[model samples]
Target chain A: MQVHIPLKKVVDNSYDITIDTLPKMNFDTKVAVVTNQTVSKLHLDYLLSKISAKELHVITLQDGEEYKNQVSIDAILESLFENRFNRKSMLIAFGGGVIGDMTGYAASIFQRGIDFIQIPTTLLSQVDASVGGKTGMNNKYGKNLVGAFHQPKAVYIDPYFLTTLPQREFSAGVAEIVKMAVTFNKEFFTFLESADLNNPKVLQEVIKQAVQTKASVVAEDEKEKGIRAALNYGHTFGHVIENETQYKKFLHGEAVAIGMVMANEMAVKMNLMSEKEALRVKSLLEKYNLPVSYVIEDVRKFYETFFLDKKSSDSAITFVLPLGIGDFVITDKIDNGTIMCVLNKFGKN
Target chain B: MQVHIPLKKVVDNSYDITIDTLPKMNFDTKVAVVTNQTVSKLHLDYLLSKISAKELHVITLQDGEEYKNQVSIDAILESLFENRFNRKSMLIAFGGGVIGDMTGYAASIFQRGIDFIQIPTTLLSQVDASVGGKTGMNNKYGKNLVGAFHQPKAVYIDPYFLTTLPQREFSAGVAEIVKMAVTFNKEFFTFLESADLNNPKVLQEVIKQAVQTKASVVAEDEKEKGIRAALNYGHTFGHVIENETQYKKFLHGEAVAIGMVMANEMAVKMNLMSEKEALRVKSLLEKYNLPVSYVIEDVRKFYETFFLDKKSSDSAITFVLPLGIGDFVITDKIDNGTIMCVLNKFGKN
Candidate 1:
């Protein structure tokens, strides 16, 4: 018999984000603000001034992709338990993608699951991680290998925090925005090509467009059961790059920037994308000062990394290739020779 | 914008359980059969003979409630990782409720979440745990205080395993069956009054009724958002009892047996159920030799334990009381004076 597991709309606990204003959500339950030392020192006061929680605690972990492991996640869970946070408690993910991912995961599993709100302070997180319900901590085996598809109660995206963001971090966020446009929104891609991303008004419009595009796609396929996989246009290659570097060498968005370029090259080789469109994508990425090149040492070694990705099946690597700018195809049927040629181009170039 | 996460229906997976025969679905992926030493000694051979997985590994845990902790759960996960089990690999929960709950939890968090199937060998699990998506490991705080609502890929029940179950364990399963009937099915309750529970034919009918009843309730309220909390008819009191005793003195189902009696007494005090109906419920439990009595040390201490229960919020302790023979009510409105009277009565006894 077909059964429907009712989707719970978590009301009474919600928040909204205006572009330049800090989010203000008053929570009566025990609230823990999870952030990295970098974000905490930079904008913790700005966030605290806006929050109206009854009793708020700040938990700061070491910053960076290397700190996204289970040890860091365990530390976060232990702190919450030590504070006697109950199921009614809430966690505020107050950093970049790494902090948001780990906090969302810790919330998802702590006391089974608890209420959590995302106060994404990173541009990358603001554009990508905030909308997806994917929450998990990284392990030695892989990134987000130990996690749950737990959605946040709400997301508070205040671009006001971005004023203090490092320039490199700013570029990283745009890399993700560029990815959203490549596979799903060609018109948005063109807008990004000419817009001054540093301008607050243009950034606000970009954030809204990216969120709406992601929200519509997520509503259609939340679990990546079908159409949602296309949203992973740059992620398949990005994950391989992240894994090869042990998630240490580049910012997550920066790695994805390189991944998107590599994907475009593969699409052109497969005749799925015209060379002109592929070059147009690289130029757009470069316009935002995002990396459009990477040095791949061994093509086979790079190809082997794809299988380790959670999205890959046992023997086949799923690729999300752009047919051009707005349209795309998901397939594992690409021949080995074509893949090798694409990898050769990125190999130590 | 409100984004709804579309729940994935695992179509490639799923199986039906029958009373007389074992399931026939075969697996080419690696399989870990998680069972207790007791169940393994008795039924492992039979289960192993039926599975045609590429490689089948047996990881036996010590058989007891005390063994259901993070240490045991981690052992299972470590073994899976050691065996190089990938995302496609599956874990089969092959014992009673404790084994099933821990196994399901390990699978849920391992590599984010992997697939798990339930082959409930105990009656209590077949009727209750196997149907719900709840998976957890207990700690000093409380029973099931840490867990997730991760449903199994499939559940398989073969009553033949029950043939070797001891009378104590067998009666424990009956306690859950009785709980199910009393809370939801009046006709089923009437059937139980005179039904020969030990008879194989009668037991099969009872198991099917309990499973189907619980399944319907879970389908409607997967996350225990509303109607599903009613399923915890005797659990609120039962959990406190189990906690106070350190989960050592009584089997989960056994504590629940005494808890049901306590709930009935409260119901009679509130005039929700007649004394005669309560007596019938007691007599049914007595026929199976399930323990329906406990000594209370202090009335206030016992009452305080209710508040610590995960279900209880700051407002009041939620009690699931019987409305009549087969109907029940889940509420926190039962006054302190009434609860005190019940606890005081326990001390007197």
Candidate 2:
């Protein structure tokens, strides 16, 4: 006989992204602000002043993507256990994408799961990572090979934190904004073509638009089972570039900047996009000082790396190619000959 | 400006529990049967004959509760990674509770999450652990101190597996069945009071009744935020006993059996259960050859261990005390003097 265990419960995982100054937040239960030494040195005092809890603790780790691993996650969990933090305790991600991803991952597994809020400091994370529920760490195998779709309770995106961001990092953030515009918003792309991000007002407007586009896509598909895969337009190739480079040569968004150009080349070859459209995207990345070119060392080896990607299935590589400036398509139908033709364009001479 | 991310989606995580001989089961994706040495020695070939998948792999760990830690979980994950098991892969928990919990926890975190089915071999896991979504490993802190509420895709409880189960282990399983009946169903409790589980028909009926009662409670509260904590009638005290003995002295269900008797004494002391009612419950446990008494070496030390329990928050300890047979009251209001008075009975002279 079959006994049905009905688990029908309305899960309200919805949260708001506030694009303004940091608000004074209070928690009745214990809270931990998980940050890197770099971010904490710059804004820990200010963050502590604005956030209060019955018992608040700060856990500081070394800065850089190199630190985003199981060891870092264990430190966070160890701190929670040492403090006797219960299930009701909350965590605050107080750094960039690496910190946000690790903090969210640690919260997702600590005592099953706990609530977390994202206070993204870097420009790249504020516009992209903070809004998405994807939380994970890089392993020996690949980046984000281990993770969970754990949404934060709220996201406080204060652009003021960008004042201390370096010029190169600021440009990296702009790459993601360009990606969002290229995939879904033509008007935003048009605005970005001429808009100067050095202007705080224009940057704020751009960040808001990017977040809105991502929010809509995520709202439609939270788990990346459908339209959500569209958001990873540049990530498929970008992941491989980062993997090949040992994640040391380029920043995440900068690598994605180059990845988008390669995808656009494939799109142009397939008649899905015009050469002019591809150049326009390349020009946008150039405007932000983002890398727009990479010479392929070995075409076959590069293609093989795609299988290691979480998006790839058993054999076929799923590529997100641009249909036009504001449209895209997800397909595994792109033949190797066409892909090689595109890769040969960037092959080392 | 506030950007709203509406993540409103209906999640249907319902699954069926089949209570009969293990049927022919098949999967199209890669499958791994996670079991222990003992269970594999007894029934691996039998299980392999009945189950088929596109790619079937067996992951065997050393048997016993002591091995249920991060190491075992990592071993399972390492095997998956080595075999290149993707998110679409499935896992079969083919042992008892430890295998089920660890398999479920591994599935919950591998590539964010994957699907797993429970094929419980022991009575304790079949009637109790198989149904609930709770999955995790014991840490240095406590038992099940770390876990997730990941429901199985399905549960296959084959009574035929019990034929090979040791007598002591069989009694341990009955302890869980007794715990279920004592706290939820009076009619079922009456049936179990005199039922000979050695009789196949009577045992099947009892298992079905126990599963049905659990299903109703789980339906109302998938997470233990409210009424679901009632199911932990014996676990709160049992966890401490297992912890105090370092999980070496008693089996999980055996500790729970003694825990139920302790709870009954507390209920009688509070005037919630009559002495006769408490004795009736004890008699039922004894009838199954389950241990119903445990001597506390240090009353205060045992009392202090409750704070480490996941169910307790800060200063208050939530006890699921019987209001009478087949009824309970979850209370934190019981004063320390009364608690000590009850502990004094179990205290070594």
Candidate 3:
């Protein structure tokens, strides 16, 4: 007789994202604030003053996209174990997307999972990475090749942190906001085209809008088994660009900005989007000083790299193309010749 | 304004445990059979003949409890990455509890969790570890100090693997069987007292009863937040013993066997269980040639070690005491003096 084990579990990973100044928080359990050196140097003192816990520890790692790997994860775990942190201990992810992702991944596997709170310091993370529960680390093969879908207990997005962000980084973040608008909300895209993110009130409102759009999509599909894949509006090409440059040449959002331009070109060629509409999207990105172009050295090599992407299967590369400003389609039907033709336009002879 | 992200998800981690000959299995995706050198040398061909996958690979690590660690976990992942095993790939844990646990953990964190099947070779794993979704590796702090609650997609328990198992290993597995009976099923405990596991039919029946008992407990508490901790009837003390010995002196099941005896003594002293009932339990373990005693070098040192145990908190050590043959209680109320008194009985002095 076959003995069936039914493991029925209902997990309510619901949490609030508060957009304002950093709030004074109280945690009875031990709390570890995981941040990078750059963020810690600027704001660790302020954060420490605002938070109180039974036991508080600060774990700081080097700041960069290159450090987002297993070594950094091990450092976090080693700190937790060295401090005798139990399953009840909580982790606070501070700094940018790299810190948030690594902290979330560490919390996911530390003693079989624990509670974590996201305090994304960078503009890109606040609007995108911090909202989603996707926690992982990069590997030699690709970005986030190893990870878990572990949602944080809560996400605290303080737009105040944006004041300290660099201009290029701020523009990089705008790329993600543009991504959200292009895929799901035309009105938001229209608003973004004219909106001045330099204005604090407007930026806060924009962050809220992007988060709400993402939250709805995530609520409908926690795992990317369905509609959630649309969130990768320009991510397919963006990942390839990041990999090709060894993640050093472009900020993640910068690569995505260029990726969105390439995708819009493909959409225009397929008659899914108009040339005028594509130009409008490019102009908006240009307003933020985000990169709207990349010169591909080898079109064929770039095409082959898509297969190595986590989103791609053994047979075909799945692409998310904009049908219009607010509508998109996920398809693996893009032929190799068409993809190469688009890449050739960006190719340097 | 506060934006609430409702991440409501219902996960049905249900699977079947088949107790019969190894059935012919087919998988379309890449399959990695993670086993040890010993198990592979003995039954790799037999297993390969019964399983077919699009791309099959075998990852062999060193045999023994010493190899259940981060190094082994890394090796498994490196192999998967080298083979370009994607998220859709499946892992088959093809050994005892150590192999089952590490394999399950590798699957859980490899690409943020994937599917895995358990083919437990030893009796201990077939009865206990195979049923629970508890997958982890031991660290310097303690056993199973780090892990994830990753359930297997299915479990195939074939007693035929036991034919080549060493007699010592066989007795060690019996300790876990005795553990299941004493905590949850009195009638089952009585049956185990006289059961001849050498008889294939009798062993299969015992395995079924144990798996069912474990299934019920796990179904109620997947994360061991409540009554499930009762299953750690022998593990609390066992982990300390394993750590003290550097996991060289005793097998996990053997350590647990001696731990059960120590717990029974504490139960009797607390009047939770009668001396006669405790003797009967010891006799049953002895029938399987399992160790019933361990000489403690220092009572105070042994008591302190419990604080380092994952189940214990900063102040209290949670103990699972048998109320009688078929009942148990989980409490941290047991004072240090009472614990020391029990340990003194087995003290070398």
Candidate 4:
């Protein structure tokens, strides 16, 4: 009556996030370095110098969160197809989260999948996006509405590239660092509050810490089934904000910064965290000049957008709220009145 | 120097293929039954009557391999977003390989993958597509060029639906069955030579054998890195045929049928298979009235198209040829002359 399609094989998909200087690597197969014009303009030659492949090509895409869509994915895919890049071929995602996400996504779906490496240039990506296997592109529906969990072959997190990063983009990266600390490690949160990231050593340590927190979480729950949802401490509200603002008004990390503040307000109202602890987190975000507030024109419209987020189920919205600091609770039990109250506090644009 | 993204976790993606009368299934989550117009007209009511869900939706796509493209994928994704389907939701691929593939693909990308069930109505899907986790759609380049190996949660192979399957479609399924027999099982090949498939019991047994053979191979390789390539015995040439004709000339299995003949020619030329063995295989194909020969207007063009296949590396095309009735050898060593000679045998379209 039944035949079993047994997939009982164990796969060691474990890879390391090596925080070192960029190494000159030689590859035996065709390789494409998928980057954006912005990153390529500053670092393309430097990146190109270090990588040698049997056949090497560069694919430059438009930069920014808005460009993270199906069109960009098609561009990366089209290049691979045109070159007759097969499963043995590889892609090197060589930019910020936008380029990394789209490139990783294109790698995931191309010929069912091929090896890809991450040479994350932005501070945000070097810490968060580069390590996790979450590859996706944003669609009109929302951020990461379409993606796959295809791990990269390796990730190189070199701090040297961050030297050319814009201050605003650098601050955007700090927001993600702050996120990791608040949800997973109180010591790291305290360290981040006082740490001067302008110092290269401090920045490297911070990148290592944030990546470690994300790595452990991803290792435990790769699919965000349980403990991994904790990583979305600020993402629930952040995704809706990104949608309402059309993904142009704020960087992804900036949106999450505001989402964390919003979640803190809800946490305070629900007695999950003291107002004092909430202020501490908010002040830390302000330290980096990460956007901590976004006024919603219509509170109801902002609240309704949460339903479109992949994190929400049909019946209720799943919110990840901090349990003071260094821990969190993933709950869908928050009442509508409580959420509306929190959203209203952001005021109007 | 390093932070580990330790994904040393084992995932058991095993599922059973049930071959019986269609069974009533109930789900607690929102469900979408993705099928085509033809299947809907013949079997929608019965399928709907047997399926109950908290929120049920039917997405009927155009029936054909040509419709298996990004446009169709977008349609499926749009429906999920419009209906507010989430990770907790499930999809039931309730038609043939086309429906199963697009549905599985849609599910794989929806919120970075979700659970999908396969209820394959066509024999080609029941014994092949429904069991393997391989999910994708065709593009202008080739068949299944873009896809993910996202396994289904389960498969229901209800033979009752096959009674209404057109004679040609039935033979298309036979092509795949004959494929499994020739590549892996000498006894199975002998069974097909004399087996009365019109007998329901005989057909069910054959389906079970094919499923079993496929199940073991998938269990060993999972991602087609080794023995699984043997399953593509006819697919390399078949994909080019489908691409050349724009997926309109033959059913997928039918193309594979002709592809098998082409591979047999190469095998006989290389002394891997006896001419007598090749003739016996061709005769079995004729018994089912499966298409065995295809004329290429330009053999050079057809030969060049093999490079476009996913199985080919940049340098050489991999071919799976039968060493005899039940054994296979995967090689990329055949020179240009031998392949052209075989294509010359097929002649112009």
Cα RMSD, each candidate? 3.8, 1.4, 1.4, 1.1
Candidate closest to the true structure, highest lDDT: 4
Off by over 4 Å in 1: A1-20, A28-30, A79-84, A274-276, A297-301, A344-349, B1-17, B27-32, B53-59, B75-90, B110-115, B274-276, B297-303, B347-349
Q: Cα miss at A125, model 2 (Å)?
A: 1.3
The candidate that wins on DockQ is 4
Show pairs that collide, candidate 2.
none
Candidates by DockQ, descending order = 4, 2, 3, 1
* Model 4 segments more than 4 A misplaced: none
True contacts kept of each: 0.27, 0.71, 0.73, 0.91
TM-score, one value per model: 0.89, 0.98, 0.98, 0.99
Report the poorest 10 consecutive residues by lDDT, candidate 2 chain A.
A307-316
Computed on alpha carbons, the lDDT of every model, listed in order, comes to 0.82, 0.90, 0.91, 0.92
Candidate 1 docking classification: acceptable
lDDT of 2 by residue, B1-349 (tens): 8899998778889999999989999898899999999999999999999988989999999999999998999899888887878888999999999999999999988888899999999988888888979899998888877777889999999999999999888889888888888888888889888898889999888888888888888888887888888989888889999999999989998999999999998999999999999999999888878888888999999998888887887768899998887888999898999889988999997
CAPRI verdict (incorrect, acceptable, medium, high) for model 3: medium
lDDT of 3 by residue, A78-194 (tens): 999888787788999999999999999999988888999999999999999998799999989889988888999889999988889999999999999999999899999999988
lDDT of 3 by residue, B134-194 (tens): 9999988888877889999999999999999999899898888888788888999888888
